[model samples]
Target chain A: MKIAILGTGAVGTTIATKLIELGHQVMIGSRSNTNEKAIEFVNKFEKNASNGTFEEAATFGEIIFNCVKGEFAMTALKSAGKGLENKIIIDISIPTDTSKGAPLSLIPELCNTNSLGEEIQKAFPNTKVVKTLNTMWSTLMVVPTMLKEGDHTNFICGNDEEAKNTVKKLLHEIGWKEGSILDLGDITASRGTESLVLLWLRIWGTTIGTFSFKVVN
Target chain B: MKIAILGTGAVGTTIATKLIELGHQVMIGSRSNTNEKAIEFVNKFEKNASNGTFEEAATFGEIIFNCVKGEFAMTALKSAGKGLENKIIIDISIPTDTSKGAPLSLIPELCNTNSLGEEIQKAFPNTKVVKTLNTMWSTLMVVPTMLKEGDHTNFICGNDEEAKNTVKKLLHEIGWKEGSILDLGDITASRGTESLVLLWLRIWGTTIGTFSFKVVN
Candidate 1:
């Protein structure tokens, strides 16, 4: 599969390298054509990896992974242009307000009313946006089953059935089990997954460790 | 231990029964002294159970459990009056906005800035407030190990270390394993646990089953 990973941050680079290992063609996108991390990533994962501007990468791949920080998400997607239209976008950005004094916090936009995923979908009317991988650390996003006792769950939500299934298949390729993949119906469900970051961060702070959430029956 | 559960809803009643089984003296509190559910709960668990007005129950116990709905939480606690002062109050209420139009939603009062636990603590300054058990169903709260594969995590947070330790002890008395109890810092951390209800409700809606969240390392 041809994949575009927007935002050359930690999450984008990490997943791009993993996807390349899984035999998927990956393009690392950045605001600048000469992004140092993007260039370094392409050099490290030489064979099937490339670097480009956000718009160029968006045009280059069949699927787009929105891994940019939530604050910059709209600007980045808008830069991706019409190429984002009619594509499967797996959004994993958290709308964090870096400006908030001390410990940092999420913006929450209009509070509990709408989610970043819903906003992205509203912005790009033709894009099929699926929200996933925002609930855990980037390391766990691609290899959830890697933890010693990891039978944890990962969630996905999207308006389009086919798009959701496509994203689910990609998640499976990356090692998430089918049973652990919870489809939380429609894009509005993203509100729940995205909001989970508040809990995840608190858990991280006190434990001083990284972890993922598993739903126990 | 003498425990007062304010609110004769399923959560209040269920935990009251479990406390009785655990050999704790349990009082079921309600707005009205003759709430039918509270009367039946005392009849069912006749050995160590009783029913009373919120104030009577609050004064009757060493520890208080706040199990009322978020909307009614303040009123219930205020009704409990100065009796709740200096007592360990285990708050399990999610600050959910039951009045939301559709799909149900949380009222991010002060918008991610505060939580119901914080609000309650602020309301009753003399109370030693500890937040726990808001993340799962009432059935799972008392008998978490009853589920076929039940080795999930439960979180507790409060400013008073001794208060939190007391709540942890109560949790252990109800079958929660020591390793599964996560202490997530001070009372402000309640924001994270309360916010988690959004995801819990979403998971419940799609899965049509009761489950609790466990943090997988």
Candidate 2:
């Protein structure tokens, strides 16, 4: 599948490269006037991952990833244009404090609410927004890494079953097992589900530092 | 330490009884006219636990368990009056959706956004609010029957270290291990930390129906 990625940050670059290496075409969209930084980031993940402006990139691929920060999620999506309609929109952003020590940005950063992934769902009501990868570290974005026994529990949630199934297939292709991609129902669930990112952070803090969770019975 | 439980529901009753059985004094607080159903719920947990108005219950104990629905947390605290000051407050409530369903009466059956818990903290400004137990099922509110390796990770967050320590002791008294009780730090984390409750529900949906998460290295 041709994958068009918006916001070529660390996680985005990593995901795009994994897909590209798997023989899928990858196009990364960026607003950076001098997008050399984003280009370099993508190159680190996989050589030959393409980068372009929002419209050009979105028009270039079948699958689009909204991998911007939780704060810039809406703006990036809004700029993805109506071309995003009916496309598989992969959402991987968490609402965090962008303004930890400075004057608070109006963004979801420093936000303690239902949040950015949710806001993405609301803003692009037509796009099939599936929430995943927001719950793991950039290093383990593709393959589901087991940190313990009975651990196939990388989760996903979306109102559209077809969209969820598509993302789940990509997850499986990226190494998520059948049992690993646990879908927790529709987008309204994003309220509680998106917060899983925090659990990942806390877990990552203690672990030898792997973005993984193993569900032990 | 005497525990004054501010909200009397399925969860409030469970926690109140378990504490009493563990040899702590417990009081159940409901609105002015708590129905027989409410008293019966407490009776299921403890025969000795007393039922009183919110203020009476708050004034009756040393440590406070904010067990009400997240939506009415403030109103319950207001009813509790100055009783919330200088105490270790164990917050087992989440900011859940009340308006999407019935009124506050049906809140315990739902979940809230990070809004409601923060609201309670704001109302009881002097009270040291530590968010815990909100992440687990009321059945596990005490301790899990089947113990497994790497099985207890309690994420606690509050601005006051001493207050968090007090709640940790309560967790220990019930059945938590020393390393299992993790301090995630600060009330602001209440947003992401409490959001894990959603991830937990997904964890619950998979096999091994009843379980809790333990942060393992």
Per-model B-chain TM-score:
0.95, 0.84
Against the hidden reference, what TM-scores do the models get? 0.96, 0.80
Residue B170 C-alpha lDDT in model 2: 79
What tens digits encode model 2's per-residue C-alpha lDDT throughout B100-162? 541111133222233345556776788888887776778676765455743656677788888
Top TM-score hit: 1
**Cα lDDT, model 2, residue B180:** 66
- Give the lowest summed-lDDT range of ten residues in model 2 chain B: B102-111
Best by DockQ: 1
Query: Model 1: what is its DockQ?
Result: 0.69
- CAPRI grade, predicted model 2: acceptable
Give the TM-score between model 1's chain B and the true chain B: 0.95
Ten contiguous residues with the weakest lDDT in model 1 chain A: A102-111
Estimate the overall C-alpha local distance difference test score of candidate 2.
0.69
Largest lDDT belongs to which candidate? 1
